[model samples]
Target: MNTHAQSPDKLAEKILRGVGGPENIESLTHCATRLRFQLHDGGKADQAALDALDGVMGTVPQSGDRLQIVVGGGVANVYSDIMSLPAMRGSGARPPSDAEVKAAMRAKSRGRFAWLDNFFEYLSDSFRPLMGVLLGASLIIAITSVLEAFGLIDTRATDKSSTWVFVDAMWRSVLFFLPIMVAYNASKKLRVDPWLGAAVMAAMMTPNYMSMLGSSSEVPGVSCTTNETLGSEQCVAKVFGLTMQLNDYGGQVFVPLAMVALLALLYRGLQRLIPENVQLVFVPFFSMLIMIPITAFLIGPMGIWAGNGLGSGLAWLNSNAPIVFAILIPMLYPFLVPLGLHWPLNALMLQNISTIGDDFIQGPMGAWNFACFGATAGVLLLSIRHREKEMRQTATGALAAGLFGGVSEPSLYGIHLRFKRIYPRMLVGCLVGGVIVGLLGGVDTEVFAFTSLLTIPVFSPMVTYGIAITAAFFTAMVLVYFSDYRSPEERAQANAERDADERAARDDSAAADVREPLAVGAATAAVGGSGASAGSPVAAGAPAPGEGIVLAAPVAGRVIGLDEVADPFFASRVLGEGVGIEPANGHVVSPVDGELVTAAVTGHSFGIRTKDGVQVLVHIGLDTVQMNGEGFDVRVEPGQQVFVGDLLAEVDLDAVHAAQHSTITLMTVTNTAYLASVEAHTGQDVTVGAPVVIVRR
Candidate 1:
């Protein structure tokens, strides 16, 4: 399945149909598992059938996307395939009349303002993927903290004596150098020069004169035995040759982040003012000369002081309220994973952990990690017995990643975001696990060697870790199990609908034996015929029926139930009835109607008993009988009906795709026994609502 071409609405429809259409879906939620659809009845689901589908990995009844499906790592690809199916066209999938299409084209042409809106939408969507990069780096920092806490290495020792030296280096690199990565991505998004952004980031990293001012000398205090300067009364300091007792300020003063901001502004202004020919050399010179002192005397010192104050306050909190520190860190940690804001704080925390040989922040974050693990486990366990093969596979993959790899992206982006209903359960599990660890005084002094299931063994010796992991798992499992899943009745109803759709599709195929072929002629000559006389077909200059025709699917979906009818006694038997197509959902449109015909009794199938007496029957899709035609709206009636361009039925694409049947439009000639020859369309992809067959008599 080519997923790239599919639309989201179309994919949603296909999924809905596979699960027995909308009738079977009581409710739907997506999470780190499969799409967790609460079915009205479980019986309606054909786990094997869904599993057999192309692009489906497997399905599970319980966890992950809820109906956990492992659609491979390229599950998104599968989703795209489903979405592209015409049967899954969503709310927009009406069999548009020619007039409607014309109107839509006109409307589209009128809206030149659409490009701006599209540009913003594109940007917003692009931002989601970067979450993984930021989170990955933060996780590395978190891990370093855990490692440092174990006393495996001396944090202060910069030499080989300290394992922490390496850890510290890693943490610093990720934190201090983060702006480059962010800038690169931002530049890519903006379609600008990434290196320019990198240059800006580099400037921020450079040391300033303010740092030198901070490193100045401090005043000496008089001790009990030392009154040397006081007794002589020459305790004078000179500033600009004016002698006075001076308070010495020494060593590495803090520079304000605003200093960097000011420098950036100055640089930009200078660049503009300088002549383009000499701008590169002169701009830097002027900017450095002017901005450096201003930064040192003002912005630099203030910023440094502010940073120091913030650091001091944090330290005080850690010392005075250790419990609060422990609780707050874990609780808020996950929130930062979604946004790109947690890096700075995490960097500082890791540094403190290494420098002080004890970090309260890292310890708490362990609780958060364990909670996520537990939630994943819960989903996996619940998924074990799931009926849907695709869901099962997805859950397994996500669960494995969560448990062993410590990469929750697969789960978070693919499943969790969709299954928002599971959010509370997962949150509660995390909270319970975190609180337990906090209360137990769990201390994570060392980072794990790796973020994987293998590392779980390393943490086994820690009592608090053990307790936290256990609590998290139990909580997650309990919540998942007790939570209401799909009801049995809903599943049954879906199953019935699916069965009906299938039957209707079969009936349509049976009716194909009676369909008559459109007249054959040159492209222009055919246009003169009654069928084309109204106007040229939407896709003009299409190949005529007789010259080795290729039948492309009118809609996207699986090719379901291709068969021929048995008939003897007619000389035209060589013209077999055309193929039976079940679009992924019940959505149907006129393949070709030389004349108005019978609207099938089931309302699931329609017969365009064409003018030539070659009856063409089109079942909207397979297994729609159970819906009792609930979502299908007939636009044209039997006998009083219309031309090929007429709107015959508007099937609910979403409802059909959800039902799990391909919503392919079938073109079957009911009286194939009368034709002298029949040939299949040759193309790989035929446009929907286009002619697909030619009959010869």
Candidate 2:
């Protein structure tokens, strides 16, 4: 029974039951502001009940058994609460493994372009592992670009000192051997032996293969020529009387990507054809025999032709209609990146660099990257102004990651996607920046660089790149600042919650000079007293002999036994008898007027010594200290005298949910050994100030 001490908890309970209980849930995970549930049976879930739940932003029912519960900011706390439920324990249906879950998500994709999804996923995974190295290389190039700009050193110098030579190699290493990296990554994506892919790509880069190019007359079976339009030398070599097309495969991603794909197919075929005993030896032998020849004859030439054709087509558009092409790329990237569909474009950029000596797309794309960081900057500003501690931390980390590392995934998944409003504002910034770049005849980079502010020096006419990215950054920051990322209702809710916390604080402060609580720790010998009315908010008067002193309910909700709580310390009775309340609302109030003892800086846990000689500890949530005071606001200081109903802290359960912690609040008598008896009135609903625990002498 999910008690309705408040709306959010009650809603959580209803959603659970509506979803056919914990037995129907395969697993639960939270991302930012939503609960992603993998259900055993999708048909068993009641969508209406889930929609009707308070604090539920919305429900997104995906294909198959995946369900997303948008619980706003407190999604993490709500997910924890759901998992903390006793019903969730020992669930009969086992959750899917990570691989299985990914497969299931992939299977759920349905559309005319389902193959596009798979293709993009393959491309994304292949390149994803290389993002770090790519960023490092870009930064290194930026350093050299800066050096050249300042006249400190010549980056184009070939006969410089050994140190300069090695420094140049640092950035060139990743760019020059990019094909091998791509081949390895693509092979891994195809579930083939990655070394084979690297080896095949490596064959073309070797001095032996490269040596064949200029020896057309000396080597009877070889011929070489440069393509008039493509500006790249092409060679044909005859090996064992077989004619083969050859090109320097360095920095050429198209060839290796094409080769590894074919390799996967041929390798798998050979594996099926060969006997198991010698399959390993025969599989590679056949793979090399079949794939090498086929690649040299077909895939290699086709890759070169394909890359040149695509680059030429895009370059033509950029020359004729620069504005449209410029805006198109940046806008398209925002959509493409989330689906991992941007890898092909990235590969194309590298292709342009290898063939045409430069790339145009990266310059305009910088506009988009800066815009993303700008939106994060705006959010960071808002968080500071409003004192939203969690949002502040999230935006700060994301901003740093973007500006320094040139990675957008942190901002994309961490902040931008979470708040729907950020996307529109960010798009506007991208548009403005692209238009500026296009009007300036479109910026181009002489090298393939990660389009970041730091890499601005790499772009030709650095002033153009600088101006465009600046416009993008300020546009997005200003838009987000003026309009704000959250909707009006969300802002109103936040204000209301804050106002309530303030009101509770004022109420507590105004009545600070009241009488002392019923008793101090002296209750060990003073349990003999009369009982108050059970119908009152709290059983306050006194207790009979051997009767435990009644401790008012710290929070409102259904009370479960200490053994039922998810915490080991409480469940093991190490913290004495106490009741866990699945909170309906988000507030931690004084159960009785007492001196504050332990006041955690994070505001998640508090210990109060009651006047009745009982030490009580109020824990807001399970493992919530990790949130570092994000969703909690402590109202009272340590040793401060507080009366009954005084607000000890104000919690944002939504924030707690967002942090991925359980909102099961516990109030325990820590020093039960000092008392005669400690009894709990559990297995029933409770409200703030209601008698839930009785500590007696």
Tens digit per residue, CA lDDT, model 1, 1-697: 2112234454455565777765455444332113445566666777776655543434556532235443322333444444355544542222222222222322322325766434322232223344444355545544543554455544444465445556556545644554445444444344333454345444445543112222242433311121221111112333334432311111111222233335556656766788889975776567556654464345533443443344445556667876676666656655544333333344455565556644455555656655655555555555554443444555566556555545554455434433334456666766776676667765555432333443554453366766766676677667765662222322232233333334344455554322112211000010110110010112223347555322334343433223322211011121124554434444455666455444543345555545555545555555565555556776654446455545667788777677775455554454343445444443334445555555554
TM-score of each: 0.37, 0.49
Per-candidate local distance difference test: 0.45, 0.68
What lDDT does model 1 reach? 0.45
Q: Write the per-residue lDDT of candidate 2 for residues 20-120, one digit (tens) a residue.
A: 88888877765433577889898888877776665553465777798876553344457666666666655654443333333343333223676755665
Native-to-model Cα distance after best TM-score fit, residue 336 in candidate 1, in Å:
2.5
- Candidate 1 stretches with Cα past 4 Å from truth are 1-156, 161-175, 190-199, 206-328, 338-359, 375-425, 438-462, 473-697
Worst ten in a row by lDDT for model 2: 524-533
